[model samples]
Target: MPKSKRNKQVTLSKTKKKGREHKEAVVNTMKQAIENHNSVYVFSFENMRNLKFKEFREKLKSTSRFFLGSNKVMQVCLGRSADDEIRPGLHKVSKLLRGDAGLLCTNLPKEEVERLFNEYEEYDFARTGSSVTEKVELKEGPLEQFTHEMEPFLRKQGMPVRLNKGVVELISDFVVCEEGKPLSPEAARILRLLGIQMATFRLCLICRWSPDDFELYIEGPDDSDIESA
Candidate 1:
């Protein structure tokens, strides 16, 4: 065989092996977490923010463990069929592990989990390619938040901005973003500059699996509610 062909085959083999190892590790970690915690909860998330989620994990570190990985791997760990089920009723919970979801194994009481989830939320600037939930318009007046030095940068972001005496002012009323429209890179940047936050970091509980039974926990929010938030 040619040298190049042999090297290519070796690379492919290594990549496949690495992937299998990762899947196995995820399964093992999930199994251990389940063994250690009292119960498991499957939760969905929106507008995921890494830093904010890190803060949440820190808060729950003492009482819980979080596992976010491939849904298929999680399902495999919990077992999809009755014959090789991980636990008595975990297969039912496994079926709910779809989409942007993950496992939360905790020793805390269910009531506390519900209360914490209810109060958990983080707001941040929307990113480019994200649909704008609300209209953002800059009026033709002095922008008190920005100084004259920032006028050039704001104008570079396609805003009709100028320096007026030591303040940044909009030369005309400009629509930074429109509802339901995907935000452009410039628009997203301008929105951040204007401090118009349009993305929410939130976790939604989908179901819970206890030793005795399985229960669907929370209903998802309506589309309008998500958009208007």
Candidate 2:
């Protein structure tokens, strides 16, 4: 009824339309990536770091390209059913494009692809809302890494701290984070300050498609096996 309400609905509608367009774009690009490259490898990744992943992409730009986006869109690009298959045997490989995975299109050999994936690992601090991989606790003692001036800020991060002479000391033992629990904003900050890296970025090849002979190879566990597990 109101102008503000109508404007809000229009914004929401635009946002939804934009998201659909993005998915369609990813599907088109993925199809192109499959068509242009010699081999297509579907790789699963966890805790992806943007900067490190970008660096890896830049390194492989000359000979390869990586496409990461919605798994459903990727599956659609590869063809979920025979009727809409992108290529002769792409539907078989598309079935393996599940979970947190992306398409890696390259002209490199299998050994080279495996080696590059292995070497491109990234370790970084976990973000807010990420599950803590390990329990972290700080004992009540002088924190030599910090100065007395940092005590106030440290206290704001839910740490019990006070200035002891010229150094910062924890007033009591604090559990910075608990394993398997979502990290809070304060917890993530404290973990960073403690130099704890809780996120590991790695990729695993789940499937491969060779265009020359139009063959599909499913690696690791296939969809049926994963469903049973």
Please report the candidate that would top lDDT against the real structure.
1
List, residue by residue over 95-196, the lDDT tens digit for candidate 2: 777778788889898879878777767899999999888999989999999877788999899888888888999888999999999999999998888888
lDDT of 1 by residue, 29-138 (tens): 88999999998999999999999999999999999999887898899999876667788878777777889998999999999998998889999999999889998887
Candidate 1 residue 130 Cα shift, in angstroms, is: 1.7
How many steric overlaps are in each model, in order? 0, 0
Please give the lDDT score for candidate 2.
0.80
What pairs collide in candidate 1? none
Candidate 1 stretches greater than 4 Å from native: 1-18, 218-229
Which regions of candidate 2 fall more than 4 Å away from where they truly are? Answer: 1-16, 19-26, 212-229
lDDT of each: 0.85, 0.80
